[model samples]
Target: MGRGPETAQLSKYFYEGNDISDLPVNLSVVWNGNFIIDNPQNIQAHLYKCSALRESCGLCLKADPRFECGWCVSEKRCSLRQHCPSHESSWMHTSSGNSRCADPKIIKVG
Candidate 1:
């Protein structure tokens, strides 16, 4: 589906809850595509969630809009630019200033 102006070309296919500070575990589902869940119990569960997807990128947010997409962090700085499917796979890095990411790296477009 085509993304609207309010939304970007990419979309987050997975998520987890921030109610609890811990991660999740014992997840059962297809080992492909991103998965969003809540009330995690451990890191292993998150690892599974990460591994389940073919190209899982972006930061795991606790909410939407304020933390919309995969690049939302409420600290001293924040970036609206969605993270690449793979952290290391990305060549760009968002700096603390504007809402967009800087330092663009050329990737081989398939």
Candidate 2:
């Protein structure tokens, strides 16, 4: 990730748990690198985003069955939950009090 004065500032802001409501109107552009100030939420989200290939199964601690072993037998399989082994402990409640796996962007759909 790119690091510099701007990155440091964004990191500090996010670490403080400041509300994003105070962010400027051009939050999308700013976060997209169209401007100097990077949106802290976007940066942190990307940093912690889970990778199916790298993450393992939280329950089994083995290769992620959804992507590798394909042995998940639950009616509501892990894939449906977008499970990320790295965030398993907090899968039910993330920093925002919501499961990141539930995010539409992360969930796989047929």
- Candidate maximizing lDDT: 1
Prediction 1 global C-alpha lDDT: 0.33
Count of residue pairs whose backbone atoms collide, per candidate: 8, 0
TM-score of every candidate: 0.19, 0.18
lDDT of 2: 0.32
**What TM-score would candidate 1 get against the native?**
0.19
In model 1, the clashing pairs are: 15-36, 23-40, 23-41, 23-42, 24-40, 24-41, 24-42, 57-85
Candidate 2 positional error at 55, Å: 9.3
Off by over 4 Å in 1: 1-24, 27-97
The C-alpha lDDT values of all candidates are: 0.33, 0.32
